[model samples]
Target: MNRAFHRILIANRGEIAVRLIRAARELGLETIAVHADVDRAALHVLEADRAVSIGPAPAAESYLSIPAVLEAARASGAEAIHPGYGFLSENADFAQGVIDAGLVWIGPPPEAMRLLGDKLGAKALATKLGIPTVPGDDSERDRVDRSAEPKDQEKADAALIRKAKGVGFPLLLKAVAGGGGKGMRRVDRESELPEAIRSARREGHAAFGDSRLLVERFVSPAHHVEIQLFADAHGHVVHLGERECSIQRRHQKIVEESPSPTIDPAVREMMADAAVTLARAAGYRSAGTCEFLLDEQGRFYFLEVNTRLQVEHPVTEMVTGMDLARMQMVEATGKDLSRGQSVVEWRGHAIECRLYAEDPERGFLPSSGPVLMFKAPEGPGVRVDSGIMAGWHVGIHYDPILAKIIVHDHTRERAVARMQRALAETVVLGLTTNLGFLQVVVRHPEFVAGRTPIDFLDRHLRDWKAHESPPGAEVLALAAMAEWERLGMIGSGSGPSVVANGGSGADGDGSSPWRQLGPFRLGERRR
Candidate 1:
């Protein structure tokens, strides 16, 4: 142990919390996991050394509650707290609370988070540092007063429109505190500005409790790439390559891979240098991501800084052979980095597909029910990070992501093939999943040729639907076999299973009637 902390509290749930608990155990440290009522029996809770109930099912009253988390930490005797990615991970006040409670906050300093967490401030800082930022109006030009009267609101809207016009049409109205595409909208024409502004602001307030917004020129036919950054208090920082997150829906990334296929070596170095420059300027430490938009012209612009670990971090880890969660734990002890940029290495290719409990045919609407069956694929070069299990409830109170399947290989082609194989082998019953849709995406000819763009889904799958084609013979046979097994109609042995004399048995010849017949049907009786 580094001695900074012996026991840590994870103030989040799902796969991330389970990830942290495993990392902490590897370092000879104890962990306390907090959960809402709906998550009392969650996989993360079962994995942690200790668990605490924070509040009700609602995130606002539970996972987002600062006091409850701190209280749990104090009660559990945890010397530190790790906010795993979402929830209060990026909340500056929560960081301050952890520090004020006399515990180590396993993340960047609250001050740094406050500065870089705001899109407008980070843009200004990037500009001062000569970093390329998207052309747009900062939040100061379009700040909305939530409590303002109708006239004042109208005045603010008018001013925002004027400033937006200056930036030109085909722009984005984004929340100053936005992340994960929340509180953001695309305005293709001048007429949509007012309604878009109102919706964006309302979403901003509802999602992040911050209605401040900024405008930016929307660059289409672009690829979304982000660089992973890690720093220490001793002023040592390193960039862990880049991730190609262009595969998205509604501006939210669904598929990510490391060693972006489209980035030039020179451009990659430049983007890494820019990310480190901004991190050093902000005095940032811990794990964070610097997002950028790579346009068709090969020019990249700084999008914003995520002040916490990203959902797609596993892709980086698979290529670099590094455990970022463990790094976070060690760095929280005020230690210098274990290695500098020179020692850092990248190998092979890594791809990650986020498995969500949603119906892709129905526009990815969240699906919730008991997970009657859950099976994860495993083998060489395959890794699954999940926080769900059979017989567990999937609620609508949180993100619908059930798990992440990450695959690594010596080449991008192999990686893609491995991911496709893994997805096909994996199974989750009782709720609709995007597994079929993901299969279609990873197998698309353009994706296979590495011609992915930000609008890949829109361009190829605009009217996609599930079950458009019939299952193959193998699939039908497997379903029948599973049903037979479930019904105990087949004996559990290596020999051929048969129904002899109206009793289940194994055939000596290993040639059963069911095996001889391509497809067999069970006799039905009168209802």
Candidate 2:
């Protein structure tokens, strides 16, 4: 049954929420932005046709509260709900709640989300479908038996160790409900298994409220690549090529590019076919991503599936010329795909760099403060999707990502050069950012040669530091003039007098008074 909706409610915040609003407007649909009290004046809220407050600043009481989100949708008279990504996006119960409330859910069906959202379940499905998966124990009985008595605890631990040994060392302990690198740990040997299991369980319980864990053999010197899939209720599914997301830190991707440099036409076809097969078997619809690990032998293993929109989706869109958000909405209405697999075309290479408000020098600690100045690079193939402005205050309550910079060009070399230029022109003056670090990564020789592995950062730039270039002579002169104006010496006769001995005023130290002004960059504070 097809249900048409005139208005849609975005059930997330930040850059993705803003992105949905634009997509909705383009389709002649009214948008309602929901926010926590702290985000009353956020860019998304200001951009939507209507805004509603769900709760306080805490996500639990606001965005994650299904009842509160549903109430906001009802109160705003929204006919459909779009969980952009994260938060309640992959929650199957939330999707059912939306459908139960007589409103459209612009995502996969609840059943499909449940089948593919769980790491264990997805792995089992892949094996059943003859898809290659990393060697590991996907057995639910192997999970830590928390409810067992003290005497049984030792038995449970021993059983888990036996399973780990069978799976082999250098394995990853992952949470069944984990995403974005949360609730995961790596154990290289048998001696570390018990403690690693306990640690992974605690982290998983805290992050996803599920302490269940799964073990998989870790693949080394591998490239993290994912296929973008789109399906409709009419049995149509197509892949939008692959994105190489091997350059990462802490298991979270920071750089992504489409048409992986390592994937030949044959490997690309195999991966695409496997992804489409999984989506079809699971009865998935709407926009989703199927992640994989590609090894040096040209073999690929299926990772978990992200049953929602991805942050790096823009790169796929840039290469395929498709509007994923719009496609999701169209599929939600029971429309068949406008095009088939053979007709889908991919062109020019594209790359995206995620900019975060974190200090790379200080171990990538998150930094929060008011954005003093924000200038995004602009050119023929540059694109920036951002959530904050000059006056916006970044808080510690949410993800530190400020924006994503994407660029496209005819060739990979040209695309790399364009990305470097765009990164250089990007400016965020108020807080410490990874702008310089991103520039360094794109310019590395190995990266240019398309040889990025999972440990690219640790293997290459482990001891990376920010290089501070001294201000130029013109900048010093301007700073001196500004300092003199501030001291009221410009118009007064007591102004600093220049001497032939490289001294100014009464000081013979060869330094100006402005030298006392501690670290500051010359730039106008944008409002």
Candidate 3:
């Protein structure tokens, strides 16, 4: 066992680093934080016992630089490294390098990372293990550039047409190694296939640096469900139930909930079983996630496996009452997980929404600026896992995520209500954020009732956007403090005022930050 390891280095930044620190502290281990120039003042760095400056602000010069991180770990005397969900978290070479540096790698072995980090490899391995997978394109089709079809082009044209017909129309072009909806396209007609393939290849190259693309059948309204599993080097594996992440935009999940409203007990058990089978086949050790797609008929198909921690690990911790990060560290140290699949008990409903600094109205584009003020929500059932606080600068160098607001309750209905209220109380005024949009989603009748499909937002999102309302007395009151700095007070507080603090400004006419710019303020307050 790694009982001798006294200190660990958290090799990432933001909320995930904070998350790892919390877990490490609880396990009676000191932690180290590595930060880039921009993240030097980040919360994770402040919370860790030791902090090290790795490199410049750009990710390539900082977080993605392996030798720099290892050097920091070695210099800090950290016995092991915990890669929390991004950057080198899934980098197989980095994991092996950590091992080669004589530092404990608090994650799956490098071999297992190879099996799961690559989309094509993971799917092929899953299928060989008899795990039913979605019909994803796993092959790189060498395009016979028709431009190179030669002067005898008529025969080549016939051959091209034959290949197109064989592959069928309405195909999905995807990167052989891609995630987060990158390098993906839905082609609804044959005429769009070649162009779609080219665009997908271009994007794949830009994102993963490899342009290999494949085509698969498009599946609509598919639910994105994943099983969180844990294993030790002893070969004991356990599934920690499934998380419903269907409420997404642009193919990325913004809101995720445990005990999926769509899955029944039988389906949950079956899905969990399938995940365990896949993990066993991989000989995976440590915490990992098995992603899948549920069709209209409720058939589950393996998508790919995330061999490291997930951004939404907190939600699973809420339902399963297990500290996933701590378990990962322990398992990496050769300690067996206490709760096996048979003993893993899920309690209550847990829901999480990612808080991103973005303009939802503008395709969720990333927003960056100084967070002059930042206020996160807090309530009986609400938990906010955030990276930045007031006075922290927000940068576009990394993901736009600000925090993850999660709520836990005994029932799904309560959980929805809790999330709605939590979003309402969340205020981030100085920068644009998805807070207002998140509130609308949380309160939508379809979402509250859990009658949502994959494309629920694609259709109903407009309904929420079209209908703009003036902030009520409460919203004005909450936003009044920040507005007080801009516009003068409305009137005396003897009785009632226009907006909160009697702030003198346009009322329901849409001049308020709450209405005009949406709920995305750089550092708006919510009490």
Best by lDDT: 1
- Which stretches of model 1 miss by more than 4 angstroms? 1-3, 139-151, 468-527
CA shift at 255, candidate 3, in angstroms?
0.3
The candidate maximizing TM-score is: 1
What TM-score, computed on C-alpha atoms, does each candidate reach?
0.89, 0.88, 0.85
Question: Mind sharing the TM-score for model 2?
Answer: 0.88
lDDT for 185 in candidate 1 is: 95
RMSD of every candidate to native, in Å, equals 6.3, 8.3, 7.1
> Who is ahead in TM-score, 1 or 2?
1
Residue 237, candidate 1: C-alpha displacement in angstroms: 0.5
Ranking by TM-score: 1, 2, 3
lDDT of each: 0.85, 0.84, 0.77
Candidate 2 stretches with Cα past 4 Å from truth are 141-158, 469-527
Give the C-alpha lDDT of model 1: 0.85
* Model 3 ranges off by over 4 Å: 1-3, 141-169, 462-527
When 2 and 3 are scored with TM-score, the better candidate is 2
Q: How far out, in Å, is residue 79 in model 1?
A: 0.9
